[model samples]
Target: MGAPDFEFRADLLDQSNEIVLVLDPDTGEIVYGNATAMDVLGYDEEDLLGTSITTVTGFDDVESWAEHLPQDEDADHRGENEFVRSDGERIPVEASVSRTTRDGEDYIVVLVRDITERKERESELRRQKERFEQLFETAGTIMVVLDEEGFIERINDRGSKRLGYERGELVGEHWFETVVPDDVEPEVQSIFEGITTGERGGVDGHTNYVETKDGTRRFVQWHNTPIHEGDEVVGILSSGIDITERKRNEDELERYESFVKSAKDVILSIDDDGFFSYVSPASNSVLGYDPDDLRGTSALDYVHPEEKSEAESGLRSTVDGDGDDVTREFRFQRSDGTWIWVEAICTGCRGGGSDDVGIAILRDITERKEYERELAHQRDALEVLNEVVRHDIRNQLQLVTAYAGMLEGDLEGENQEYAATIRESGQNAIEVTRTARDLAATMIADERVASISLRHAVESPLEQVRSAYSDAVFVVDGAIPDVAVAADEMLESVFRNLLQNAVQHNDKAVPRVEISATVDDVATVHVADNGPGVREDMKDDVFGAGETGLKSDSTGLGLYLVNTLVDRYGGTVHVRDNDPDGAIFDIELPLAE
Candidate 1:
């Protein structure tokens, strides 16, 4: 204690710019002041040394400061308050007051700093932030700021207006509570959880009803984003876009799709990868496979072995985008090992995010195919029978005519009546044989299958009928557009037989024949006649091999041959009454590829 630690005292105040003052704690009197303390307060060292610290820079409220100060000498303390300077100016300051002992002398050390500029800048920043909040509150779209807990911390003016609520009503409430419909709560919650967990960044295309304060609901599409602070999520930001009209349209589309899927016809979609992406449940009853089993499986796998090559070629054409529509008649394998005949129509185009997809629809034609086979067999048998009948009947009829000629020359009186009867009977027999040969040849040749144009096939036979019946007016109505037909020969036979029967069997004063063609998903040929309609009792027998009208003397095989040929061509033949009392025959045939 020889130098009284003068050097230690200098070192203590030399390193820091803070104003340091030593005071007598018990009397609140100033005992010493540092160089910085004098400069900061505009005071001289001698002026502060003798005066009490409170007298030089008095606390704004001495009674309050005195009461807040710690009473115990053993504890340290800190506080903030204003002080009046020598000039009588008020300044906010933070004072750290600590009780200390130096050389066994009890005293208090006060460290102080002026915070006037800092406080001014803080107040300016708060004003600017308030301005920004005011601008956000006046926007048009519903804007919401949410904390990490999904609570609505702030909402814009438009949001409040649309929701029919005041701004305060929304703050502190869950953002989802006002927007999410009760029916969609589960879905909205799941999406929210996903966003919160960082599983999804944003979600669009969700349409839900939002309930307003007025108890009305409106459809809206929400766009959401996760708010991140550095690497951590702090909250979410959401914008609502009203889409009530769009939602209604979407609902209508879904309803239409549902109806199509439930239709009796099988509706399906095949991808460019040659796989069935969508197959209706009706496929189970039609194709012998569960709809689930067919999905992602190649549709070509079900094609019959014999028809696989053709089906594959058609599929390739579709995949290459070379054909818009390609149709083929093939057999499809059933679960029972047997094959069912089918006519498939394939339409090629881009699908499923790629251009390599193909789609096809198949219709079962097993019954039509079976009928065709039976008709072909019957036609062949009838041809052989006709050849024998023509040979024997012609020979017998020629002998009877020759004998009738000789008897006419040798007879007189009563014998003449017998000769006349024999001669007429022989002539009738010859005519019957001729008609039978013509009908048999038509049936046999018509059984073979070949592709031809519908217009040409139907018009050619109609031309012949028009030529044969000069007195009967023949009018071909409706345009017979070009179409592909598998069995041209048989269909031609059917058309010719129908036209001839109409002309020959009609009792109308002016016999008229109408032949028309209609092309659609399938091609149809309609042949009608202005004739006394077929008797109801004879309609069923008209298609029989040997059935003929009670009034007609012809070999009654015309309608029978028409039905046979129609069936051989994988088509149907049905009878109907024409408008003005006549027979109408309707035939439907598959289109050519």
Candidate 2:
């Protein structure tokens, strides 16, 4: 039996996933094979044990495996080779061999790993290199390669001819000394130095002058890309084009052409017969059409039908240059067939090439026009309301006051009581105008709302109403909670309206009004009155926009104002039956968390 440690080592070798082999060094014959070796070779372990190493690795024979044995007796051996399987298939592998001895027998141990994936990756890399080389040489653009020292390492065929140099003449030469003209060499050298020192990045559209062999120079715009070795810039790749002629044309047209294209208002000119002659580049965004598409289209095609009064005049002016500059608003049709309100300033842009063409500069005025129209409508409505409140209502109230005063002087005893009724009716009419003014102010004032004290809202209104009607008994239960509700300062008016309506409509000799509040998830206030209550059928109608219940001189806006104010504060108000009699104004408001 093998020694205990050798047996332990043998167990480890059998369980290992690596292919293991033992060969007699002298004969180069396999003496032992591990499980992995048999599995890879597609042979039984017993068959593999006695076979020659050449039987599996067809690329080598016994002498080849032992070739290094004599030179380095105890050294490790490694090589790349192909393994031939029993099923007539070959696989690539990397093998490591070392000399070993057991029981005085010289032997070799080998371990191998499959390298198919690594070989495939290497093949793909080779093909990509070939493709890059082909494109680099054949591309029409001028190409130059510079090393970290700012020396030209390579330049393609097209670049050499452009600079009037034989191929390879400029290789190994510094860019500043050999190629760049004197006027721009200093700047070129500074950029290269900055790139080498890591102070600047790669650049594009760097225009500079380059000298030719004939002593003339051309302007070239170049884009430089830094080549990196890991994270460090080691070289630079540049592609350039000659822009000598392009720069000349740009100098002539840059000033005025740039302004015409970037103008805020879209400018278009129409030729004779009312066909579009020139449309600014801005038409792409303003009208969603390419400028060329409107070149021959008529201008009236986009005018709205209802706004065609100036259509014939505008078209004739564009064709004959007959009209002076006129500013007017019109609805022009957009590409999506929607109408856009635009104010066009049309003028006779005549005497340049086409004598019959007219120019129009259209500026968008949709928002301003809409606001002006809305304000005009509001002013008209206000004029009518002033006529009613200041003239019509005033005259009628004056007549009532005059008649009541005269009746009081002419009558005597119980007949004069009619004058008191008439005088009271005039006073009520005055109160209506005052309430109307207050309601108008409230409706128009947009105030910010927040959680405010409900107790204060009810108490302030209750005290005011008591002072107005001293004969009425106003009872505010101390049980009202010190809670907050989502509302604004207008909350007092809400309570004032409900309380005043309760006492004002009361039939009792002494009106009794009770006020109480509770706080839960919502704060609720109940203003109850001991008087005639609202019927179920008329409960909702009592809060209608024009509801005046049993009161002839009322504006019918008191209860309506109460309900509207409560609703605007995110609260609810409704009438319910009081405990024994009368109406109850129950209000619910959201409680502040």
Pick out the ten consecutive residues of candidate 2 with the lowest summed lDDT: 1-10
Q: Estimate each model's TM-score.
A: 0.43, 0.42
Query: What is candidate 1's lDDT per residue for 1-593, written digit by digit as tens?
Result: 11123356776785668777777666676777777777767777667675666664564444544554555567767766665666777777777777776687676777777777777787888888787577566655678888877789888878888889998999999867765678878887888778878888888766678888987887888888887878877887778877777778888989967865776555667676778888877777877878898888887888878899999988787777775798888998877777889888888767557544666777889999999999888987997888776888788998998899799889998798799778866765665575567667765663567788888888887787677568899887868878787676555666776777786677877888887888887788888887888877877778987776535565767677677666777888888888868888888988776
What is the C-alpha lDDT profile of model 2 across 199-298, one tens digit per residue?
A: 7888888988888878878788888888888889898888888887887678667966787799867888767667777888887777767889877898
User: All candidates' lDDT scores?
Assistant: 0.75, 0.78
Total backbone collisions for each predicted model: 4, 0
Output the number of the TM-score-best candidate.
1
RMSD of each: 13.3, 26.8
